[model samples]
Target: MASLLCWCLEAVLVAVLAVVGGVSGQVEAATPRRELVPAMFVFGDSLIDNGNNNNLPSLAKANYYPYGIDFNGGPTGRFSNGYTIVDELAELLGLPLIPAYSEASGEDMLHGVNYASAAAGILDITGRNFVGRIPFGQQVENFKNTIDRITENLQSVDVAQALARCLIFVGMGSNDYLNNYLLPNYNTRNEYNGQQYANLLVQQYTTQLTRMYNIGARRFAIAGLGLMGCIPNILAQSPTDSCSDQVNQLVQPFNANVKAMIGNLNANLPGAKFVYIDITRMMKDILVRPAAYGGQITCLPFQTPCPNRDEYVYWDAFHPTSRVNVIMGRRAFNGDESIVYPMNIQQLANLDLQPNNG
Candidate 1:
């Protein structure tokens, strides 16, 4: 009886310890963190756009109803129903939400500036169908203008050092595929095959990125194209109502080239550290369990979206919900090799990339 009592007591103690450990782990995760980097400069399309397109005369605007339904500040021109991936990423970095270049000024420009615009692409003519949108080439020019403003307050050397310490995230190429090549209005398909186009984009992209490095940027996180075929808009066009495999296969070359480009950039550019964000891999698990999320793929413009936004995957045919934004942001912040090549966002932020200043 004594031996049995001792064994029972040990089992009870083990269970109690396990419960306490689990609770403590949960609390630790909830703990607030300090800012990781000085600032984060964001550049991309509607996937990350936050109101830069609102004042533009582009037909690609999303500053209404279904778009900012979940946002604290309504209709911020983000495609999704609230916080974008960049917003979530800013939160993860313990930084305030970086303001759009259009609306940001004075102290707002200090933390960071988002240059992403709806319908923007790596190529100048990619989103012509939408008209009045800022292309990637012009966005870089806009950044130079921003640098001038930032220089007004800080010394030129200080501006360079601060920018080098900051994180520069650029997610391009989606519009290059969806709007430029695939659309009948554009002759991109006739001019170049998938491989050729990917090559052309990467070639141009190389120059744009080099310009960034020449100016000040040092730590970079370049986001690759995700599963564009898997988007609901693509699905709606599919006769079988499934992900278009052909479209998925077409963008692989672009993603692959971008990865190779990162390797080349890291090898040649001094003080430049660039990591590729594999968005396709980031969405893999979420894609497999579509049932857990609301099965709806497309949400019409101006129409009300699904009730439980978290349960939905695609906020609309093109963008993702706030739930996905947070998940992708968290993954990029801490995910392993499969998600972000060479290093992750958190690691990039921690890099002591104090520029030479010479």
Candidate 2:
């Protein structure tokens, strides 16, 4: 009887151990995990600017009440009524909301930051004439300073490697030509012509990009000039609300020059990835079919009672609305195969994390 009792006791102990092991295994499976990707750093103008210009005294500030009125019913410094393209892209990537590189509150170094400033351009002197503003070169200097500050405080990971994985986004130069060159102030349209300006802009771009590359940035997403002539502001200047052919004619060579620059960058940097997101075709499609695109909104200058904004392209007179930004991001992330050589932003980042052997 004693021997039988011992056997039964051992069996009970084994049964308890089995139950505990099963519970631990189940818990392990239920836990969530996060995928790793390099940091995302943004640089440019109002196109990707997220309230960075808010704190700056620049006249280009767009973080006023009506700007973010659509987002949480209050101002968030975003030029749109809601989140900008940068915000949406961060959400898609599962990264924490990237703060405007200018914001003084809730700063985090590990995730990322935006150094974009409204009225900023590729050239150092691009927007200096504007009252109270930060130029592109200054913005880059500020970015470098910020990185130093973050490292000094955090002392977390390998800064250079972190930077290498960083996906640097640059969107500028349009305003340089528009507000500076094309406008009455410096209208070279009759003199230098469009092609000359295009060449100058490309040359300037090459210089700026090399600066970034030297700073350990390997991945780049450079968007080409959009259909500047089709913007509502430009159209408003016209008697019939028609797009300016002269302006578009200039844009063609500028975009081509930009494409050539990307090819050259790729050829020089074997591991580096450079891409161009064509905005002209996307803008053209929307302008051709305004009703189909959702650009219809009754805001006086925009024509009477606008239609659904989802289908349209232009958000305002100059910059794209959040809705339009989302559309562009989707196209950029998925439609690279149909465009010129280099892939889209999504593909470029993917390549950085998992480089191909062949």
Q: Please tell me which predicted candidate would have the highest TM-score against the true structure.
A: 1
* C-alpha TM-scores of all predictions: 0.89, 0.79
For residues 278-352, what per-residue lDDT tens digits would candidate 1 score against the true structure?
999876666764433223433455554566555556667677776667667777888888988898999989877
What is the TM-score of candidate 2?
0.79
Q: What's the true lDDT of residue 23 in model 2?
A: 19
Which residue pairs in model 1 clash with each other? 294-311
Number of the top lDDT candidate: 1
Residues 1-358 of candidate 2: C-alpha lDDT, one tens digit per residue? 0000000000012222232234121111112224234567788787777777677667676655445545664566565546666666665555666777766433574677788777777756566555555667776777677677766765435666667667777777777776667767664556677788788878988877877776667788887888877766676668876679978876788889988998999788656778887878765543443332222233432122123333234445676655556555656655655532468665666674334211
